[model samples]
Target: MNKLLIVGISGVTNGGKSTLALKLKELWTISSIIHIDELTKPMNKLKYDSILDYHNWDEVETYDWERIKKEVTISSQNLLNSSRQLACLLNFYNLHEHHPILFIEGILLFNSPIDEIFDIRIFFTLDKEECWKRRKERVYEPPEPPGYFEKYCWPLYMFYKSELENKIKVDSSKSSNIPYNINFIKGDKAIDETLLWANKEIYTHLLNY
Candidate 1:
């Protein structure tokens, strides 16, 4: 089977991870997408936290990383096999070219087990103020409680942001041992620009491959 590249999109809430994933899917017709939200534990299973006084869905602990890893592994194999079959069928008709890239997008992909699964990772970020502004404009099924973003969500994201920065610093110091390839994207920029940046990274990796 040919190599299949896995790309991860993650970052702060309401920071446009989903939008970028959708756009990339449109651009890469054969690519498959796996959203982390689909792999989250059910709401009933999420106990309310004493600190937040609410079910904290923003943290890494809320997600099932084991399940995520399993699903990704399965999906990767499926996409690769499907691509091989498609290539054979297309070649029979005198056509060529099949690039099967898998996009795994989520809010907390930087966490353990999940982070190691990605060949390329893209993080979208915006200032807290901007994030709040855009978040307020959208609606969620499990409505956000009052002070949720200010009291819990934003703080948690900031914590993760700090951790990511520190990881990047450490990785930079060890040129030969970088564990990840994360591209930090400014979420406030134009969508087209962001798409171009992501495309460039993916294409560059494909070329190197």
Candidate 2:
């Protein structure tokens, strides 16, 4: 039987992780695509509402990191219950028994223990300025306060970067004109271009294995 091909797509927030995941899902109909952000959205919404009373960053800073981390972890784990749902649905279809591919896309996917679960890992890179600009434009709740990106997400991403090996990193800030040799697709390109690149790379990797 073919073993599962677990591809992890990860990057800093607003680095196009979700867009790339959606493109890959479109490209690979046979593979299952899981987006952790969708699962975590409800928790984020609740937190956003609850924090509205806090005037600004300084006020929010009154909360300690240790307590914040514990709260966030619990919320995140609750959100991950969706993963269990997917696993059950897959088993219902006997997906793993038949050895179908699986792709999980999220930020911090390579953070510690979860890093070991994937067979292939891809990171999307973008300039910090570009990321900030995109985050500001998001239609949801509102933009994070200035410095939040640097203080929070970037440090975690850098930590994950140091630990990742056998990973493909794609520069998402580049225009579509430039050609990349890797199978990992960047969000800056057209869907067709991304699909072409992804299909070629995925097939090549499968063949090699």
Best candidate according to TM-score: 1
Consecutive 10-residue window with the lowest summed lDDT within model 1: 90-99
lDDT of every predicted structure (CA atoms): 0.81, 0.53
Clashes of each: 0, 0
In model 1, the Cα lDDT at residue 123 comes to 90
Model 2 bad stretches (over 4 Å): 38-99, 140-143, 162-194
Tens-place lDDT digits, model 1, residues 137-196: 888767777788987789989999889998888887785744545788889999999999
Q: Model 2's lDDT to the true fold? A: 0.53
